[model samples]
Target chain A: MTQRDHQQKKMQIRDGFIAGSPIVMGYLPIALAYGVLAQQSGMSLMELTGMSLLVFAGAAQFMGANMIAFSASAIEIIVATFVLNFRHFVMSLSFVNQLKRIALPWKFSLTLGLTDETFSVSSIYRKQANQAYGQYFYGTLILVAYLSWVFGSLLGGLLGDVIPPQLSQSMGVALYAMFIGLLIPSVKKQHKIILISVTAMIVNYLLQPMIGEGWGIVAGTLVGGVAGIFVLDEEENT
Target chain B: MIWMIIIGMAVVTLIPRIIPAFIVDFVDFPNWVNKWLEAIPYAALGALIFPGIITVVPEQPLIGIVAGIVAIMCAWFRLHIMVVVLSAIATVFVLTL
Candidate 1:
């Protein structure tokens, strides 16, 4: 509100924007893959764009589109997506604390950009910054991600099955690589992360062939995360 | 139906992020919950990443897995983003040739 406060806010936005640039390296290819997948799924340009506008999360959107291509019922598609994406809720809990003092409407916009990549990037920036422009910094990052995803989907939609199947399939590697990059920074902290990683792999592998593909994500998250806590508690107490 | 999808996306996305706000109001969690919480992202990212790595590749199933390794290593080294990307792309490129 004050002149000094406003200036500081502007500076935070600028640095957040600069720091956030690397995230685009991750977003662009993933978005491009989303685009390619959407096309392969037979989504019309409008439907793909509509998804980009509404759903926005790349993996969930891909899942939803793939389900639609298979003639999945609307309920099935929506539920599957919700299950796949529920981890964002966990990401947001701590995320919202900083904006606890900001107004409701701005918080709403910040939530839009709270996709996994955005959450990781912005949260790191927020820790370095004072509260002055937490909202602004997040806003810029989300805006860039949102635009990249939508546009990439649009390009994929337009390209439409032209991409070779091998290339199409290989695109899945981009996001997996991003995940590994994210993990390197925190991998050393505790046995808990190591245990959790092992648990997630086991749960996913065990559950996928038995329970189902889409369902494993929801199950793996809860089972793996909870299992890690129990194991940690026992180890720490003993 | 469209509105439902839009609203569904909005609510689902909103709920996960907001759970801790009202969540603590009703339920109490133990201290270990903090350690569990720290690994949540890795848990989530692993779910996504595992499928990419383990899914069998076609022409050379080995190439497919190798591509995943190369890309992640390139990315890990903080190699130029374009190079990291091209590493995977080139892996597929050579194999396809």
Candidate 2:
């Protein structure tokens, strides 16, 4: 690569790190909670960290840990995880389409790091970025977030007892708060987002008791996406 | 047994995430399909927050609700995401104390 291209690449990676900092902040406490919970549930430190390394998903890992604590069967845990993570299908599709210029190999590796937080950050960033950002931006973004999650889980597993229960428990609000932060900006720019988001929230709330939280999220998102089709203007998409 | 479940969960989870990258190259989507995919993130973000937020502090659901509202207010003011999150965490910590 030329000197200018290399410099640009470095800048992209740095920007990615900057973009990833908030995710690092958001993922740490939750990952820590997962680590503590998993350890308490009889998972060895290796097993819990291994789950973080391999799965790299927050909600599903927590759910998996809970099912394990209850001695739920392997098949049951797997099915529950699939149900919980089904939202990723749409996310991956949108993410891949968003970065269609990036190579297939990069897309595959990037998708491995895709989570609710990273997807939201990247989707929003792509729209607002004035210049063309490349895969290195996303690669760095995902890497930092991934490392924080794994490291935070390890730390929480080792120091779970050291931290006070109330403090650790309070960290649960961090992820939701981050979501609100992500949603509010877009809602300000485009009023349609309010309707889509509120509709999804209401549907998930109503359906949660019946079909369960996993299915509730899936159904709510689908309903909300359809709501967008009718409500969102074609011009706003650009 | 734990290993079995961990591996199983990993496989099932990865399938949904990785499959799209491979297949999306082959099939072209319609305009509406693209629209639906574009809308997924907003909708998913909403679904993730609600119910999950209220239930974050199961014993005191009000803590989560109050924290969530604090987050919304902070975010509305265009504060940094880190600030928004920490404010909510601090709110919860104070409320629980």
Candidate 3:
């Protein structure tokens, strides 16, 4: 890279770090609570920390811990987790174009860190950062968030009562609340999006008994995602 | 007892992470497929956030959920990320109290 290229790359990295800080701030408390909740639900420190680093999605880990606490079989937990995380595969596909220039390690590592928050920050900066530097910046974001989550779990496991019950219950809403922060920018004039989402919610509520957790998320996410995607494309065409 | 189970889960969880890293150095997904994946993240966020805003809150779960949805809508339209969060928390607190 030339001097200008190098300077530009540095700027992109800085942007990623800056934009991602807000999300990291949002994530720390929730990750901490997830850790504590995992232990409370009978998960050992190792399991909770592993999910923080490996699985990395708070929602799935929360559900997984619930399943494990109930003494669900490995197969059931695996299937449940697979269903809960099926959207991840879809996310992996998102990086295909942007990641084409990077080496395989970067691609693979980027995929590992592709959580909702990470994707939002990284994708916003990808054009400026390019594939290689975008992955590096995103990795930095992941490392920070992952450390917070791991340490949070450790703290919660060891320092249980230091955090009040009222606070912990309140922190439980943080993840969902973060979802609100994310959804705000997108609930634009796309009526199909609104319609598709409402339909999926109804479908999920109706299918709660028959399809169960794994199938419900899988079917609902696809139906909703595809319907919203296609419908918007048609609207833009006109 | 839970510690032992945690150890076991740690091992299981690492497989998914390590497998793709080791086996697939670079992925080559087709362009058309890529187009669809672009929509997945926003759609997924939408689905997750919607139910969260509408769910029954625990203390005063019923009213909190409704109030939260309204608070979020106002803050969102105003483009204030912080206000959205604070309002939701305040709504829950008010509904419960």
Candidate 4:
């Protein structure tokens, strides 16, 4: 590329990193908690880093750690995590639409870093911009998020003993609060979001202990998403 | 043994995220399909958070509730996400003391 093109590309990558800063900030406390939890559950530092590196998924990694503590079978752990992360499939599809022009190798690498937060940040950026961002934009965004997650886990694993128990326990609340922060704004825009959300919450709560933890979420999302389609169409027509 | 489980989980999780991007064409999604896709984030976050609040601070459910409320207020006012998260964590910490 020309000098001007290279300059512009660097600028986009910087913007991507800046846009992803909040998510990295958000991931730190939560991932720290994950590290502490994984350590407390008897994961070695190497084991902890390996899981964070390979899995790179927060909820599933937490769940997998819990199952490991119970000495649950390997297949069970694999299947359970797979089910918990099924939402990524939907996210990838949505992202593919906006990122259609990205090269295949770059798209594959970026997809590996896709999380709920990264997807949200990238998609919001895509919608606001007239054109798709270059590969560097996504690369930097994912790079920051990935570093926070892995490093947070590593720190938690190594220093978990030094932190006081009450403080560590308090850290668990940070993630759920972050989720609320992400959810409420969107809910305010469309009232139907509330309906879809509440319905899913109720379904998940009721079904979790019976059918299996992961399936409850799956069932709830399907019901809520289907319900939202009808509600959104009605609102649009009115 | 642990390595095997870790690798297994990675492979399974990789499929859902990677396969669709590789094979699926972006154009020509029906409107209803887009609507359905749009709804996933709301419903997914809701389901994950609501039930988690009670359980996350099980010994002190009230702290979790307060933190969640504080988070919603911060988000509603359009505060930075980091501020919202830190404030909520502070609420829980102070409450537990």
Instruction: Note the Cα lDDT for every prediction shown.
Output: 0.64, 0.87, 0.59, 0.78
Which lDDT tens digits does candidate 3 get at residues A129-198?
3543565566676666666666776676676657655544554455556556655555564435565556
Using DockQ, rank the candidates from best to worst.
2, 4, 1, 3
Model 1 over residues B1-97: C-alpha lDDT tens digits? Answer: 5446646765675666555555443454566775466445556666655654655354456776677778768756767545665677677666666
Q: Pick by TM-score: which candidate is best?
A: 2
Per-model C-alpha RMSD: 4.6, 1.7, 4.3, 3.2
- Candidate 2: where is the Cα deviation over 4 Å? A128-133
Better of 2 and 3 by lDDT: 2
- Enumerate the chain B TM-scores of all models: 0.58, 0.94, 0.64, 0.86
Q: Which candidate should be chosen as best, given lDDT against the real structure?
A: 2
Runs in model 1 deviating more than 4 A are A1-7, A18-23, A29-43, A94-108, A120-126, A129-131, A159-170, A188-192, A227-238, B1-30, B56-61, B71-89, B92-97
User: Given candidate 2, what's the lDDT at residue B93?
Assistant: 93
- CAPRI-style grade of the A/B interface in model 4: medium
Please report, as a residue range, the 10-residue window in candidate 3 chain A with the lowest summed lDDT: A229-238
On lDDT, the stronger of 3 and 4 is: 4
Count of backbone clashes, every candidate in sequence: 2, 0, 2, 0
Clashes of 4: 0
**DockQ for each candidate?**
0.40, 0.79, 0.34, 0.67
Q: The CA-based lDDT of model 3 is what?
A: 0.59
Model 3, residue A145: distance off in Å is 2.3
- Candidate 3 global Cα RMSD: 4.3
Q: Which docking category, incorrect, acceptable, medium or high, applies to candidate 3?
A: acceptable
Enumerate residue pairs that collide in model 1.
A89-B16, A89-B17
Clashing pairs in 2: none
